[model samples]
Target: MITHIVLFKLKDGIDRDTKQVAEAVAYAREVGHQVPELVDWRVGWNTVDRDISYDFAAIGVLADLPALQRYQENDFHRLAIEKWRLISDWVVADLEDQ
Candidate 1:
């Protein structure tokens, strides 16, 4: 199995309380249900406050690399990502379970 993880920091001047931010978070949380290739999906706002911390996180599990690729290419996933792009800068990591 592969674990796909993403951390996002809101861009300058983007308010965390805005409707757009809420929509972005909701989209991230729901995309796993929308994309069949995603085996598990989890996303949330950060509760801890720290200077270096990201504002939000998304974690998902896929069966393999091809599954991960299919999730990325899924139309619903792409649209959700576009909404996130408008509000944040993010980083991602993918790991395979041993």
Candidate 2:
């Protein structure tokens, strides 16, 4: 399987408060539920005391590289990512079966 992980730093002036942050987190949490290639998904908000250089995270599992690619190319993904782009500085990595 492939594990796709991502972290996001909110753009300046975007996430104005805890409510905004919660909404953004909710959006990310919906991705895997709506996308087929996503076998599993988890999303989180930063709560550690350390400097929050990043505000959000997404972890996803897919069956293989092709499945991961398909997830990346899907319209649902495009829309979701575009929404994230307005609020985030995105970072991502994908890991395959070990």
Highest TM-score model number: 1
Candidate 1 matches the true fold with a TM-score of: 0.96
Candidate 1 achieves a global lDDT of: 0.94
TM-scores of all predicted structures: 0.96, 0.85
| lDDT of residue 97 for candidate 1 | 94
lDDT of 1 by residue, 5-84 (tens): 99999999999899999999888878978999988899888999899999999999999999999999999999999999
Off by over 4 Å in 1: none
**lDDT (C-alpha, whole model) for all candidates:** 0.94, 0.81
lDDT of 2 by residue, 8-60 (tens): 98887875475656666666778877889999998877676467467778999
Ten consecutive residues with minimal summed lDDT in candidate 2? 15-24
Point out where model 2 deviates above 4 Å. Answer: 16-23
